[model samples]
Target chain A: MLAKIHITLKKDVLDPQGKVIANSLSNLGFEGIQSVRQGKYIEIMLDGNDKNTATNKLNEMCEKLLANLVIEDYSVEID
Target chain B: MLAKIHITLKKDVLDPQGKVIANSLSNLGFEGIQSVRQGKYIEIMLDGNDKNTATNKLNEMCEKLLANLVIEDYSVEID
Candidate 1:
């Protein structure tokens, strides 16, 4: 099984890296970009076959180490 | 319009960050028993209405700034 996780900053938290990217894009002549937010995409291969188990493990992983719960949110998908 | 992009290292490239995460997960008692790969997810809010134009601009942005073409691959989704 494979678990795909996406971790993104909470809406209230400021993202300086994303701001830099937006500014760089504008400098590169790309216009009309109102805002940019960056996050993490993680792919984990598990040696299990059950989707339920994978999902549980993925959520645990996010809570324990993958995401900074105070400042970020994470979503998991199992396949 | 909104553009969501996922940038990932090519399969052949080594990802030290991901390795560290995997090791940490293992040490934390999470048994993955496989591999983990990490990537970037970016969301861009555009002040335009046309999806076609947004897609084009997004591709250009990825090629020019968002991704390192030599070792990373990126996919863009316009919404």
Candidate 2:
């Protein structure tokens, strides 16, 4: 099984990196860009075909290492 | 209006960052993790409801600054 994870900063968090990106975009002539928030996209290939197991394991990975739970949230897609 | 962009490495590219990340996952006891690839997810809020304009501008950003066209491909979603 393969899983894709999207991790984004919490709404309340101050995204300094995002702000920088937004400013850079504006300076680079992308004037239509109002705001920019950057995040992580991780693709993982797991061992077997058990959907439940893969989901649980990936969730564990997200919680343990892939994300900072206090400031970020992650969602998973499996195939 | 908002746009989401996903940037990923081309298959022929050597992903040393991904290799290191995969090894780190294994070392951290994520045994089921077979392969790990990392990418960027960018969320951009645009000025108006013109999806076509936003799409073109985002594509320009991707090609010019957000992604290395030599090794990365980017896709955009607008709303």
lDDT of 2 by residue, B1-79 (tens): 9899999998788878878878988888888777888899999888978778778888999998899999998999986
Write candidate 1's Cα lDDT for B19-62 as tens digits. Answer: 99999999989885499999999999999698988888899999
Task: Report the Cα lDDT for residue A36, model 2.
Answer: 86
C-alpha TM-score for every candidate: 0.97, 0.92
Per-prediction TM-score of chain B?
Answer: 0.94, 0.89
Give the Cα RMSD of candidate 2.
Answer: 1.4
The sequence of per-residue lDDT tens digits that candidate 2 reaches over residues A1-73 is 7899999999889889989888888888778666789999988888889998889888888898889999999
Accuracy of chain B in candidate 1 (TM-score):
0.94
- Rate residue B31 of model 2 by lDDT: 83
Candidate with top DockQ is: 1
Q: Please tell me which predicted candidate would have the highest lDDT against the true structure.
A: 1
